[model samples]
Target: MGIPGGSAPSTRLLLLPGTLGAGLIGLSLWLGLSHGTPLRCFSGVAVGLCFVSAGIAAWRLRPRSRTGPWMALLGLVVLTSHLNDGLMLPTSMSGRELITLFGTPANWLQVPVAELLFLAYPSGRLRTTAERRLVTGAFALGAVAAMVMLATKTPVPICGGWCGPSPLQLVADPQLYLRLRSVFMTGTVVLAAAALALLIRRGIRSTPRQRRLLRLITLAAGLTVLLFAATQLFIVAVYTGRTGITPTVFLFETLTSWLAAITLPLAFLAGLLRQRLAFASVGTLVGRLEHVAANTVEAALAETLRDPTLRVAFPTEQGWIDVSGHLFHPPSDGSQLLTPLGDPPVAVLVHDPSLSEDRQLLDAAATAVRLSLENARLHAQVQAQLTEVRASRQRIATAADTERQRLERDLHDGAQQRLLGIGLTLGLLRNRVRGTTGRRLVDELERELCTAIGELRDLAHGIRPAVLTDQGLAPALAGLARRSGICVHLDVQVTERLDPLVEITAYYVVSEALQNIVKHADRADACVRAVHRAGWLVVEISDEGPGGATTASSSGLSGLADRVTAVGGQLQITSPPCGGTHLRAELPCA
Candidate 1:
């Protein structure tokens, strides 16, 4: 019978290995308990169970990783090593043949497979060509040694110096077998030591986060190498007649094997559990973020992730900015990573590169805070838009001032100069004309031309005054006082030049107020006061008039108010019935 979906087939395929591993472990246990020592059997069982359980959990957590499957294979290899152990053969003929043919050689694969398992830890693949070649050579050497033992050695012990002799042993010479065993054990020791050294180097060079994850596994690998080395040395001593295999020695060997087996898988599981706990903290972060404010979201995320240097920045029309709406530039030293939070990205997370090792954790944390980030992004974008609008208004005001200055320059330099030249020509003609009537006509024409020139100069000054642009606001205010038709008392305190836009805006405030006084104040005496204080230009115009004037009532005052605001300033007017009118304008100088 088949399962329901396409995934079912793969799921079932994964289940096959789990089932086979369990059965082999069961068989190993039954054989060890019935024919060998019970403590040794339980220790071997514990080792197999640890590898199988850790492998399955790791596989489920990281489905794409090969580390899980390799670990499971290590468990199977350990379990199968003890399946054929016993001093006596099975009563059945077929069972004896099967043990000699397959089970005897399968036991030899455990050492090389275990070494390869450590070499592929965490990532599940050898990182370098040297590592790959080392593991490949170990497998090949182990296979050759297994085959040689079956062909030429007799009375061969399997299952790490317990169990029984090889039923497939062909040659009768025990000395020949000892020499072969020595070579194989020496090779095993060298390979195990190399793998252990590589693991130590990895620990020393790892980042803090990486070290935390690998600490237990590294300890297990180091201990396994020591036990294997000691076991090999003892075997060599026995073969050289320096020692004999007493019951105490046998027990020590059994204990060493069991300890090595159990320690490795338990350490691996412990490391994996630590990593799982790190991932689980993402759930806690979600709960904490339920009530977080938009501005404080960055701090909350950093605290939860345990990365104090973590920063969240949102993308705006004006470029990248932080939660507080200030411009942000990511680091250039490559110490940090940028993870975009959404499609087209609402925000970017700048964090330590170590966090990149677990992309899933980073992604989960980002997902948990995505809504807060979106809100923050929208707020930043709105602020940027307001800033842009203000800048545009200022640009328009500056352009209008520039155009007014141009018109003033054209009138002064073009039409007024031509009219003066005409007057000079008329004077020359009056001298040339001897006729009395002709001279009188020439004088009359000259007088009319002078009047037109004076009118044109006044028009140019009204547009944009040359005195305000050249001399500054004090001279400009003096000019305004003299030009006014009503009695004016002007008090000028601004000595230094201000921004051109500010000066122009201030001049208009006084000019427009004086016009209102002339039209509505019944010729009341006006006081125009200008002062500079605290990076601002303050200009006040007041008149003792029977007044009820305001910016809303007068079109000129309305326009003047707008002009002040364009330069990021304010205009206020206060007028009461039969009382004095006070107009104040505050313009920023900076």
Candidate 2:
């Protein structure tokens, strides 16, 4: 039972029975017709027995079926017909006597009843019990009708001779006799034709193996109908006084009947062989589908296991191809399996062995899994790089802060203290000199020394504000606002102490913003506010200005933004329509 087109060992064995049956039919037909010795009758009987034997063997070999009994019945009928003809025909009559005997109702009935038995051969493999009973009943009815017609008949022309008394003449009712004959002949032809047509139509729509079985059954049925029809037509021609039973008609009827009788058993054998082949084909196809499905499952499993983000889906409940892998699952026995990919846990379903074979699909799935793993690895590397960059920026900010503090100390201890000492010496010199010229010179020198001390203090404050250390960010910003000669409001909402570096960064952002406002805002008042929210210190400095402030043109503000960002803070400047500018900074408090 291989696939119809596959090269399999069982196909060879399947062809053997049909071949042998055909050969046996051909050999038997040649021996029975070509030879004319007394042994010819024995040979015909032997050939008929062979046909019966083959049919019986075919029936027995098939599954327990109604077809088996039907075939067995057909074989028995053929054997009895041959045996009866052999024993009675030649022994009872010479050539002229045989021609005369053929006119008898019994002879006509025997031939038709035997022909009707051929119908059972093809349907012998797997018919239901009901169908078998119906067929048997039909055969019994046909046999009874033939017997009844034989029992009551009047003289009727048959092939230029007379069959007397013919059943129609003896019935004494011409209409009833015509009706019965017409009905019986028409029904048999119609039923046989319909059965053959249905078998052919079914074969055309079936798989190759089924087509073969149907072909055997249909061929058998067709031969039986052809032989029966020829016999009926000859009877009609002879009875209507249209033609004689010439040698040609006799030869044709004998040859056709013998061909049909021999082929019937072969047809049964062919049908049985076809059934075995069909079963084998189905098994093979099932195995192939299972193999394909297993491969798909393995591939999907490997991919999902390797990468959490990757998924696979099946489009049909059972088929060879998968339509979408991004979202699909295997069908569940009692639970719902079909769901979107984003659903929680994103379960991976196990494949059924019946649906597919698991081993063949693993390599491609493994490759996909590897690729998903690589993608995940690359993402982790990117995050690590970002963390490293952030740490580097923090280190740079710390170094910058240390350098600024050192410079502020150098200016305050070295430059500012020296300038103050020089101013004190100049003041003493002014006191010592009494003359107007000396006193004026000393006072001018003291005034110049005091101006130098003030400039140095301003420079030290710019490097690292003294007020930021002494009074915190809010007052330093407010003092700078006052120095700028702008009306400023300070709102300090944060009460918790922050990291020193964070405070410095916030103060610088405010100072730079206010300086920009005073130099370029061309407006009246400004407000500064600081608040702590969600572990961050937020500083907002707004001003009533001309309101076209831009970070791109303000280098000081841009530099302050960089410094704020270096300490892990953000700066935003919004200058809206009308006269207003807003600068906000958010810094981590921890």
Clashes of each: 0, 15
Best by TM-score: 1
lDDT (C-alpha, whole model) for all candidates: 0.76, 0.54
Stretches of candidate 2 off by over 4 Å are 1-369, 577-579
lDDT string, candidate 2, 411-453, tens digits: 9998888888888888778778999999888878887877888
lDDT of 1: 0.76
Which ten-residue region of model 1 has the weakest summed lDDT? 1-10
